[model samples]
Target: MSDVRVHNFSISLDGFATGAGQAPDAPFGHAGERLHEWMFATRFWHEMGGGRGGSGGTDNAFAAMHGPGVGAEIMGAGKFGPPGWQDDPAYKGAWGADPPFHTPVFVLTHRPRPSIEMEGGTTFHFLDASPAEALKRAREAAGGQDVRLGGGPSVIRDFLAEGLVDHMHVVQVPIVLGRGVRLWDGLESLEETYDIEAVSAPSGVTHLTFTAKSR
Candidate 1:
């Protein structure tokens, strides 16, 4: 089956999905950049946009999921940024001049915004589309390929509660957040079990594969 998945999402050992104090200026929150330090060290991120000479292994295994059957993506405003498409003179697409994902992206938001056409096939759809609406668009856009729940903790959690995702791969970081957003918050009843498909990665990033048990 086509998947609705969260792959390689990094979180601190302390259980915080993101750091505290988020806003238009600080999207990932104070020192939240630390949350994904492992990603930056990976060759996949480097090939995508991080330039060259980066470590591989963990990031590559995680990033290998990027192209394959993955066809579309859904992200919240916090992940896409600026919240509104009010035409900031300084507005830049989420990842500098261009983003890596060439597939259509549905960005979940409360306000209506215009679409952003980036260099690649990536056209950003500003969805006033609620979580359900966003998922619908992503599924359609996916063209039977898997749709990725590409992030901001609350957004992923919402899909989890709805039992939408078929699989997931999270790369647990060594540090801890102590407090902030959480991946499993209020999701204890989801009736899912992780088979622990793999544990060791060359980059010290643990790769965990999970599913809905019966699916």
Candidate 2:
């Protein structure tokens, strides 16, 4: 069965998706990277880079839940934002030599940009279309496989509030952003119906999986 999943999505104790002053200078933000410290020790993460000999523990189990994905992903423009790329014709893509995502990645953006093709079966498609359109295109490209919503808070909340996202995995970290970007800022209405299927992980991070249909 085709499944749309948000795997290993990190969040802070205060519900912040990212820390203050987030920009190109800080990839994960000032203190935002702290949210994903749980995943850093996972064997799955290590294996993704072709590394070996990892500790199998709670963090590993938490990371393992993301699985084994489907085929495609949808992300917001914030994931890769840069004014320089818009001008330089020589600029290929944000991802360096070999990015982990070896599949079709649809980036939601209003400004039109040329489609970027990369090695390892990855292609960056800038979608001027709405979020629904992008997800539809991604689902078709998935070919019956699952489509993941690789988000930047706003995107994920939009999908959830719109009931477009089928399933999601929210992994909460012990840290607090204090004052920053939040995951479910204005989507409190979603809390009434969206049901959490499971909540597990002996690791420091709390893993919560939710399904919209369960409502």
Candidate 3:
């Protein structure tokens, strides 16, 4: 079976994945680009933007793992857009016309909508299903490749709680956001089931990889 993996997920020292007051302009809210500054400095990000000159160090090494061998992606509605995006029928997504995920992307939402096919191979399919159900659909669309779990924290938490994730890479940024959406809330003793390894990069962020023990 293809593994379900998460890569380059960023969180603050306080475990907050995203900050409060998320508007159209403030995507990461009060946290701004602090959580992703390390990623932005990576060559992977620069190359994605059709640019040059970026760090080719450990940050780039980690950021570059976001894609590859992933046939589908499952992301939360929060990751799709800011709050109340469902109200706007014209809202495509936060990623403009061409999203980074060039696979079938399944969005978990209470209000499902018609799938939007973008310029690239990426297509947004909204679902009101549980984590398991959504994963089933994504796997079907994956065509025998691994499934990528794209997140904004809450969706990751839900999948973690259900033991649906096989591999996960989390980046702990050296900042403290006192108020925001947390990632570790309700997930206790998560280290037991998964083999966790931490590597501190020179950029002051720690990369934690969690691989589930043989089941």
Candidate 4:
């Protein structure tokens, strides 16, 4: 069976994944790009830009795992764009023409839209289904490979709450957003479900992994 996983999902020291007031100008809101500074310094990030010059250490190794073995992705509407993105008929998504996800990307929204074929292998498919239903569709699209849970906090939390995620990697950036969408909200004693591992990197970020225990 293909596993459902999350990789390089950054959260603040306060457990917030994104700041409040996400608008067209401020995607990360008051938090800005602070939460993802560690990833931005990694070679994996630069290489995605079709360039060189990025660090190659623990952070890079972790960032590198974001792509491989992922045949399809399921993300929230918020991660697809800012507020009112569906309103705009011409919205191309947050990553523009060529998104990093070179697979079938399923966006979970109340209002489903037409599929979008980008420059890369990414083809956006909008759906208004529950976590299990969406995961089923994505797994079929994955063609026997793993399905990635591309999140924006709330989405991740929902899947986690439903016990749909098999593996998860969270990068804890050293910052306190105080207010915003939190990852750990309503998830108490999560260590019981998954064996958690913590590795602190040189960039002041802590890499956390949660692998579900065998049933």
Candidate 5:
């Protein structure tokens, strides 16, 4: 069976994955780009944007694992757009026309809409299903490859609670957001089931990997 994995998911020192007041302009909210500054400095990010010349260090090494062997992605509606995006019939997604996920992306939402096919082989499919049901659909869409769990924190938490994730890579940024959506709210003793490892990068962020022991 293909593994369900998460990569490059960022959180603050206080465990907040996203800040408050999420608008179209403020995607990450008050946290701004602090959580992803390390990623932006990576060579992988630069190359993804059709550019070059970025840090090719440990941070880059971790960021580079985001793609490859992932046939499909399952992201929460929050990751798709800001609040109230469902009311906008014209809203496509936060990513412009050409999204980075070059696979079938299933978005978890209560209001399902028609799938939107964009450039770079990225197609957005909205689903109103539980985490297990959504994963089933995503895995089938993934063909024989692994399924990437794209998240906005809450969705990741739900999947984690259900023991649906096989691999998870979390980046703990050095900042502290006192108020925001947290990742480790209800999850306790998560380290018991997964073999956890943490590596501190030169950019001051700690890369944490959680691989299921059964795997």
Candidate 6:
């Protein structure tokens, strides 16, 4: 059976997945790269950046889980681009021509667009569908592999609310954004449905993994 998973999604100490005032120039808004600095120091991230210098520690181990077994991805519109990106017809996405996700990616948006085929086997399919509907499409596209719930907060929240996610990995960065798009809003007592484990990384960030308990 294919499972829905979220890997290495970062959140601030204040619970903001992304900072306020997000724009083309500042993708993560005022929060900047503070939320992802820990990942940047990982060997997995360094390799993604076309470099060969980074730590091979806990962070890298968790970051590397993002790939294997994932066949397709479902992400929010915000994860695909900055604010107002949908308005731009020429938007190639935040990852440029060669995205790290070398699989089918379904972006949830109000305005749907033609599918984009990028380098390294990545194809972006824009869809305006509910969480269940979108997951269905992604699962089909994934063939027999698991579908990854690539998020920018809202998407993950929606899936979690619907009790659709099977495994989730979140990295809690040690910074307080004060204000931004929060990941846990309205999601009271989420731990009740899942077996949650927390591990602190040497980088001061806590790696939280959630596995859905059998019903």
Q: Score each candidate by Cα lDDT.
A: 0.74, 0.76, 0.94, 0.94, 0.95, 0.94
Please provide, for model 1 over 1-215, each residue's C-alpha lDDT reduced to its tens digit, 9 standing for 90 to 100.
67788877877776577777776776667645876777777777787774776776656767667667889989877777644534563454566556877889887776646777787778788787667778888888889998988987888888877777778777777876677788878877554444447586666767667776757
lDDT string, candidate 4, 4-40, tens digits: 9999999999999999999988888899999999999
TM-score of each: 0.86, 0.89, 0.98, 0.98, 0.99, 0.97
Clash-forming residue pairs, model 1:
13-175, 14-176
- Over 1-215, each residue of candidate 5 has an lDDT whose tens digit, in order, gives 99999999999999999998889899899999999999999999999999999999999998999998999999999999989999999899999899999999999999999999999999999999999999999999999999999998999999999999999999999998998999999999999899999999988999999999888
- Candidate 4 backbone clash number: 0
In terms of lDDT, the poorest run of 10 residues in model 4 is 88-97
The model with the greatest TM-score is 5
Model 6: lDDT of residue 52: 100
Cα lDDT of model 6 by residue, 52-166, tens digit: 9899999999999999999999999999998888889978799988999999999999999999999999999999999999999999999999999999899999999999999
Candidate 4 stretches with Cα past 4 Å from truth are: none
Task: Give lDDT: candidate 5, residue 21.
Answer: 85
Q: After superposition, how far is residue 202 of candidate 1 from its true place, in Å?
A: 4.6
**What is the per-residue lDDT of model 3 for residues 45-137, given as tens digits with 9 covering 90 to 100?**
999888998999998998998888899999999889989999998789999788899999999999999999997899999999999999999
Cα lDDT tens digits for candidate 2, 1-215: 56677888888888888777766666567775688767877787888778975659866776776646668888887775643455655665567657667888898877657778787777888888777788889998888888988888888988877678878888888787787778978876675666775555666678877777653
Model 3 whole-model lDDT (C-alpha atoms): 0.94
Q: Which has the higher lDDT value, candidate number 2 or candidate number 4?
A: 4
Candidate with the larger TM-score of 1 and 4: 4
Q: Which residue segments of model 3 deviate by more than 4 Å?
A: none
RMSD of each: 2.6, 2.2, 0.8, 0.8, 0.6, 1.0
